[model samples]
Each structure stands twice: as C-alpha cells, then as structure tokens.
Target: MNKYRITVADKNPLVLSGLETLFKNDDRFILTGTARTGAEFIELAAQNKFDIGVTGWEMPGLDGRAILDAIGEFEYHPKIVIYTGVPNPRIIREAMLNGAAGFYAKGDSTEQLITTVASVAAGQMVFPYFDLKKLQDDPWESLTRRELDLLDYLKTGQSNQQIANYLGLSVNTIKFHLKNLYTKLGVKNRAQAVAVSLSRKSNH
Candidate 1:
C-alpha cells in the first residue's frame, strides 16, 4: 500500500515537533516535510508533491489563506487541512472557499485531528465543531443563489468591482445584491457581511 504523504507548517516549534512525533509511529501517513512558516511551506510545496498539507491559519511570513491561494494557482494542488487555533467562521469560510478539504481547531482531540486528516485525504469535507441548527436558522439562509455567489466572492476578500467582473455582473447589480445581503445578515459593511456569512455556515 502507498503511504499517505503529508506536510505540516506552523509557527510553533513544539507543535511541529509534536506533529512529527505523532506521525512518526503511524505507518498509514508519512510526514514528508515540516516548516516553521507559511512561506517556507509554500516553497516546499512548490518543490514537492504531497497528498495533504496541514497548516495553521495564521503564521509568520505568509498566512494560510495566502498560501492556499498560491497553491490554487498551481496546476497540481494538494488537499489542504487547516489545523488552526482560530475557529472563527470567517476564517473557516475563507479556507473552504479556497478549496480546503478540512478545518480542525487546535483544541480538538488528537483522534479528531487524525480522523479529519484521514477523511480529507480520502476527499471528504470536514468542518470544525459547530451547531448545525444555528446555521439553518440564520436569516442569510434565505439568500438567493446570486446573492450567495456574491457572498462567496466577498469572502475571498474581493472588492465589489472585482466581484462584478468575476460574476459577469454590473457594478450596480453587485451593489444591489450587496445591499440586500447586508440587510439580511444585519451587517453594515463587506467585512462584517463576510464574517456573518462565515459564522452562519460554521453553525452547520
């Protein structure tokens, strides 16, 4: 059987050491590389082919989101698993929008982490623990498909004009949808709207 090849990146030395040790005894997964920052991880990723990339959302030099974006531009992209301390809905949403296979909080149990990685490697979506009912009850759940598309673009940190271009909609139409989304989500600005949307999705 072919062992699953994995790479990990985080700012903490202890976390890096711990992860290395954790995978060292596991025959199913081989830790191919480890890095102290996102930039280092990106450099390694560009040079090597990996089955999975486990990284913290926030790291020195380059953030996880930026790293994921860079990876997205590559012809060959590894399945990404964000093992982060930040479990905020916005972060999770951004990771998902960028094609992350899973999000696992640092506080999650070791078993949860292992299972999440395995699941993601097997091509499944994994979310950090959250209340599903709350997401269902959110007012934003009523958003139209167009609005959802706009919101998704917003979550990627795109400007209204950028969203308009990407969605092939006019600036006026983007503004109208943004207004409707803000009212429904009870948010006043693009950043707040994106945050609320992410929070709502995390509830699921």
Candidate 2:
C-alpha cells in the first residue's frame, strides 16, 4: 500500500508537536514536515513534497485564505484541509468554494481529524456541518476578492474618493468595482451594499 504524504501546520508549538506526533504514529501516513507559520507551509508546498496539507486558519503571515490563494498559482497543487479554532461559517464557505478538500475545527477530536484527512486524500470532501441551502442563497459567495475588499471599505462609510485614494486606485476604478460589487450583492447603491454586507455578517 502507498502511504499518504502529510504536512501539518499551526502557530502554536504544542499543537504542531501534537499533530506531528499523531501523524507519526499513524501507519497510513508519512509525516512530510511541520510548519509554524503560513509562509513556511507555503514554502513546503512549493517544493511539492506533500500530498495533503493540514493547516490552521489563522497564522502569522498568510493565514488560510491567503494560503488558498497562493496555492492557485502553483502547478502542483496538493489537497488542503483547513483546521481552524474559530470555524467561521463564511470562511468555511469560502474554503469550500476555493477547492479545499476539508475543513476541520480544533474543537473536533483528533481521531476525526485523521478520518477527515484520510477521506480527503481519497478524493472526498469533508467539511463541518453547515446550512447548504443558506450558502447557496448567499450572494456574498459570488463576489470576487476585489469586489469583496471594496464592499468592506463601503461598510466603513468611506467616500468613493477616499476609498480610491486608500487603495491607490482612480475614482473611476473604484466606481467600476462598486458597480460590480452592488450587482453581486443584489443591491442598487452603496447604502444597500453596506447593509447587505452587514446583514450577511450578522447572520454568520
């Protein structure tokens, strides 16, 4: 049988040590490496040395979302399982849409983590329990990163000029992003856009 290659990443020393020990004990996996930060994991990933990457959602530099984004640029993409303490629904949803194979919370049992990693390595998706229908209904899922950033700035009640200056973008560029953002959120204007963003956040 071919053992699966696995890498574990977390900011906490104890968690990293624990996970390393856990995977080391399992006969099904070859513990490739462990990383204390997202950047370290990204470096490990770049080498294409592992088959599955089990990582924390929040890290010192890149974080889970950034890791997902960076993985897109790599030619050899390994499966990713986001193991987070917070387990925010929005982040979970985004991870799913971004091609993450699994999302495991720190609160879950280590045995479950093993099972999730195994399932994902077998080409199955394993994620925390969530409202699938609600996620399907959410317009926030349709927004691109740029449009999402613009929506966040809109939440702060900033003028178009201010946002443009802050982003180092022209007013026309900001307006264009906003127009797309509004359409994604099903809102007609800035006020409605902000309100929709807030409502979705509060629901989560």
Candidate 3:
C-alpha cells in the first residue's frame, strides 16, 4: 500500500492539533508538515514534497485561495484539498479549476474529510458535500474570457485606475467593464463585486 505524504495548513490550533493526531495515527499517511500561517504554509510547500495538502480557505496573512493562486503552477505542487467554511459556489469552482483535487466544507463530518483525502490521494476526483449541477443552475452564470482576465486583476486588490493602467484601457472603459461585471455578478460596488467575482469558479 502506498503511504501518501501529507502537509496540512490551518489557522486554528485546535484543528491543526486534531489533524496532526489523526495523520500520526494513520498508517497510510505520513505527516510531513503542519502550518498555522499562510506564509509558513507557503514556505513549507516550497521546501518539502507532499502527496496531498489539506488546507482551509482563510489563513493568516494570505487566504487559501490566494495561496493557491501563488504557487499553483509549480512543478512540485501537491494535489490540494480545500477544507474551508466558506461555501461560496464561486470559490468552490475556482479552487477546482485552479487544480484542487477536492473541496470539503467544514460542516462535513471528519469521516468525510478522511475519505476525501484518501480518494484524492488515490487520484480520484471527489466533491463530497457540494452540488456541481446546482451551481451550474444558480443565479451566477459563466463569465466571459475578458471578464475572467479582468477578474484576475481585481483579486489583487487593485484600484480601477490601476486596473485600467495594467490592462491598457482607458479609465472610463475600465469603469464600463466594471459596471458590466457587477451587473453580471449581481453585486453592488467594486469590492463586493470583486469578492464575488474572485470567489466564482464557473469555467464556462
């Protein structure tokens, strides 16, 4: 049997302690590292090799989504499993699209997480508690290609003027696109709009 090496990151000390205990007890897994902060998690991931990494959506300094965005394309990146409380459909979809092997909500039982980690480590795609079909039919429709590019910049916490400068578009044109983006996402204002936009995972 393969003993999958593991690394876990979470802000909660209690959760981390529980995970450390569980991983230590599991014969099929090797607990390589545990991280309590986003910065530490990033550093650990870069320095070690792990088969599976289970982490929360929000962490210290950098949130899980941002962490995924940072080193997602690295050649040694392990399969990621998101164990977060944020149930936004947008985030769930995005995480998968960005190479997350699984997404498990915090409300799910520990048994579910255990099974998901095993399945993901075994190279199976598993989304234990969320309904992908329901999200497809939800109020949030798919975003356009240009909209996705714009959304990427928005997630970096840039201003409209700065986005316009980066995208090589006039400020008024950026504002127009921003307005359209807001309307499509059904959110008011840029910050809320960006939050929803960044969280959305629709790939169509």
Best-fitting candidate, measured by TM-score?
2
Q: What is the Cα-based TM-score of model 1?
A: 0.66
Question: Relative to the unseen true structure, what is the C-alpha lDDT of residue 171 in candidate 3, on a scale of 0 to 100?
Answer: 89
lDDT of 1 by residue, 89-172 (tens): 656766787788899999978778888988888889998666556654766545654677688888788888888887677999
lDDT of 2 by residue, 30-113 (tens): 999899999999998887578899999888877787888898788887899999898867778888887789999999899999
- Which lDDT values do the candidates have, in the order given? 0.83, 0.87, 0.80
**TM-score to native of every candidate shown:** 0.66, 0.75, 0.70
Compared to the true structure, candidate 2 yields what TM-score?
Answer: 0.75
Q: Judged by lDDT against the true structure, how good is candidate 3?
A: 0.80
C-alpha positional error of residue 61 in candidate 1 after TM-score superposition, expressed in Å: 1.8
lDDT of 2: 0.87
Global Cα RMSD, each model: 7.5, 3.8, 7.0
Ranking by lDDT: 2, 1, 3
Clashes of 2: 0
Question: Which one is best on lDDT?
Answer: 2
The 10 consecutive residues of candidate 3 with the worst lDDT sum are 139-148
